[model samples]
Target: MSLVDFSSDAFIVAFFLYCFGFLFYGVAIIGRKFSNRNPDEHMHKWGRIAFITSVLGFIAHLTFFFTRWAGGGHIPTSNMYEFMTFLAMMVMLAFIVVYAIYRKPMLGFFTLPLTVIIVAFAAVFPQEVQPLIPPLQSIWLKVHVTTAALGEAFFAVGFAAGLMYLLRVVDFNSKEKSMRIQQRWVEFTLYVVVIIIAFIGSVFAFRGMGYEAHFIQETVEISSQGVESTTTDDVKYSMPPIVKPYNSQVQSMDSFLGMKEPLFETPSWMKGVDAARKLNTIVWSIINGTILYGLIRLVLRRRIGAAIHSVMDGVDPEDLDEISYRAIAIGYPIFTLGALIFAMIWAYIAWSRFWGWDPKEVWALITWLYYTAYLHLRLSRGWHGKKSAWIAVIGFVVVMFTLIGVNLVLVGLHSYAGV
Candidate 1:
């Protein structure tokens, strides 16, 4: 096979290896009770095996990265698919570093699943290598994207540990108002995770079934000279449309589950062809996520968080909190250098400005400031355990919005990064 084709195959291998690594970690944790050997010995043996598998997966992922870079004539991080995969790989690297330090089997149980989810999410975007745009052609693209993603990977590890901290300490049996509030918020977080998984699953399912729809969207633009210009573009959907683009007509739409057309038109205020598609995707994700979450609830007859909390029984909340804090502390400076410093340097080169209030730039600043506050509160306010864990979790949410949400919802210099 060509190197590019080989790289694709290697990526598939890496993905399966990561999935197996997750399953093995699950076995290391959950199968201890079933084993005839001493529980500690069983967990130690299986955790070692799981860690080895994860290391092999990381190697394969690295092979994919370098091979694709060689074959595609650019670093494999110029698009959403490439960047997410690189982020997943860096998460694995960060996990390896932390796991080596702690030797905690439960960390693998949480981190591997996270790595798997991220890899799967990366697959949702187009994978074909494309030439970088003019703005992305500089050496700073490699420097900025890789370093920023590496820093975010540490944050992702912190998120896993923080989530584990919650599952470890939160009382599922408590009837107190405060505990109930905590339970609800934890459940909501799990629901959001399930929504992401559901969205990925739904995308792949419809893709496998070859579902598609098409539309012609007319965009009206006004020039500085007050000249009105109209442009029409073709928009395609891989899933059935629940909402058609505003002020656009259907070119052709395949019937789906007895539905022949969109149920509604996108609100006029939501401009761009992508806006309607993105809103439609959100609607589908929510619908499918609710159904999937309902099925899980039916099976367990308990909240998903409670179910997970049961497995967290022997894990220490204090250690998890410490790991979360350490991971974020390590990442914070790297993020400052990459997402802020290198970014401004590149912005100076590309846009001839050190700072501009672009939506992406604004959100990047928001994320940085939020994390800065996180560190401040953590150091000065003595926020430990649950408070620290919650901040870590919420901080990752802010990071994700800066990375993904800005691209999807707002148009700016970073719009090209969105799929």
Candidate 2:
């Protein structure tokens, strides 16, 4: 196989192995009653075995990551596919590091599933490698993004810890909080998320079946006389666009939604029509995610979180709370150095301006400030337990918005990160 092909095959194997390892971890935690003399000893021993499995998976994954780098002739952080995959790897690396320090199997239980989510997310984007664009032709691309991803991965661990801490400490069974996180709303939101995933899945699935939304789009092409003229270009939405912009015209309208323009046009500045075109993909993913979630709920007949919560009875709330704080303390500075300082230098080199207030740059700052507030509120104002945990959780949300949201929702110099 070509290095890239080998890398792809190895990545699939490693991905499945990670899933299997997570299942093993689940068994370690809750399966002790079924087949063990001493529950505690069995849990510990099985947890170690699960960790070993994860380690093996990580090695395979890391090997694939590097092989991709070698095949691509640069680090794999320039596109959504590469960045998402690399981000998952970084999260796994952070989990392994924290697990080594604390030997907390609970951490893996919390963090590993995120990689699965990330893998699903990465699969949504195109994987074909393109030549590096001018803005990304810098050594700083590797340095800035890698370090920033590592920093965010550490913060992601804090997010997992904070979530666990909240689950353990918060009385979700309480009437008021339960009412606030109303079952209907929660279910609805989950449905939306899952439907989105499913919609995206359908796109990939149908594309494999040679399905596409055949459409005609107007384009400007420079002629041999160096004069630009408007021309009609035939386009296809591989994922089956659910809707196109109001102005878009399709010559051969099919049953597929993309063959016709949407009734509404998206109001966007930079991305414009491209932004409108993307709505279908997003909408489809939400609907897709919702359907898949419903099927899962049907099978389990219990809220998945609550079911997972039952297995985590052995988790210590205080430990999770403390570790969450410690993780932020470690990650914040690293994030600043990479996402800010190094990023500025790269920006200066690429854009001839250190601070253009690009959406990505602004969100990175927002993330930094959010975490800073988290630390300040925690250490100075004596915030701890539930409050601090919530901050950590929100801080990571801001971090994600910076990484994923900015790439999707806005257009800027960091366009390379978008697929």
Candidate 3:
């Protein structure tokens, strides 16, 4: 089998193994709370096992990635498959680092399932081999995608950590805070797992089938004379229009960096549609996925909501609010630099415009403004807790929109992505 196929097999195996390991770790947590066993005993033993398994999975995934890279001689982040793999790798690496620092395995409860879902989606849309498009051939492609994914992973960690903080603080007023805490963990795990499954299932069920174009035969008057009539029937398939290369090679910023023609042909019919659609799909997927998952969890854990409110009765919501800020403080600037400023700089060099307010560009700016407002709310208005967490969460939504929404829905220079 080709290395790509091998990589797919390895990834599937590794993901399943990780899932099993995650299940055990969840049991370990529950075993401590209910079994009257030493929580530390299980925490130390099973946490180590979970860590080791995740590490092994990471190594296997890396091997698959490296093998593909060696065989393909191209960076792996260029397509959906590679992007998901790359994202999982980054989240794993970040989680491991955080685990080492906090010595807390609870983060795994949130992070692992997320990684699994992303990998699962990656598998759903298997990687296909295609030559690198000219725009993706730059060394900056590696730097940009890598840094951006890393930034996103950190933001994800922040989200997980923030949620943990909320869970911990929520039960402060409870008569049995310690007792309820364990149950909270269980509920959180169940909720996350259910949400991921529901999302994947929903996407599978609702994914749009490609369109079918049909032609109908009809008779119409062909002339001013009443007797003259003609019958015509024409059918055309909804094929993307073909766009030929501008030349044998694209103009390069440096003479030493000779121009190379794009590997894939741009569809002429989609002169301005593809990129917008692609960006929109990305944005909508994130928003809809989060909303769907959140609603599902809310429905499943209706009683837990009341329990959570009771727990938070005496806790400082302000601290809960500020935790998200810590995440945003780190994530927002990095996101801006990677997703916007740096991208625009690259665009200027290639397309000769620093900012064109294209759909993607405009959405990015909107995301930037959203975070800017978030910071303003935190600093100027002294917001914290529920309000702040809400803002932080919304900020992520904006980021998602900038990253995926604009690329999919709005037509512009980026229309090449077949959004």
lDDT of 2 at 384: 96
Q: Cα deviation of 68 in candidate 2 (Å)? A: 1.9
Residue 72 in candidate 1, Cα distance off native in Å: 0.9
The per-residue C-alpha lDDT of model 1 at residue 120 equals 94
Q: For model 3, where is the 10-residue window of minimal lDDT?
A: 239-248
Worst 10 residues of 1 by lDDT: 308-317
lDDT tens digits, residues 1-419, model 3?
Answer: 88877877777777976786687667655555655667678667887788888888888878777878766789887765677678888778777766665556666755787788777766645367557777777776676677777666666666666565565554433668764774565355445445556546544544443322222323345476657775544322121112222111222211112422222433333323233233333343555556775775577565444443442333344444444466566667777777676777777766778888778677767776777787898889987664566566555556555554454455566544421
Which prediction has the highest lDDT against the true structure?
1
Candidate 2 residue-wise lDDT, 1-419, digit = tens = 77888888878877887888788888877787676478788889889988998888888889889998889788878899989889988888888888887887777777877777777678778887778999899998888998899899899999889877766665435568564474344345345446645765776786677755555665555789999987665555655556664345655534554445344443433244456556767766766676688679789887655555566776788899888887888788888889999999999999899999899999998888888888888889999987888788777778877888788778887766886
Every candidate's CA RMSD:
1.5, 4.1, 13.0
Ranking by lDDT: 1, 2, 3
TM-scores of all candidate predictions against the true structure: 0.97, 0.87, 0.66
Q: Which stretches of candidate 1 lie over 4 Å from their true place?
A: 219-230
Q: For residue 327, give model 3's deviation from the true position in Å.
A: 4.4
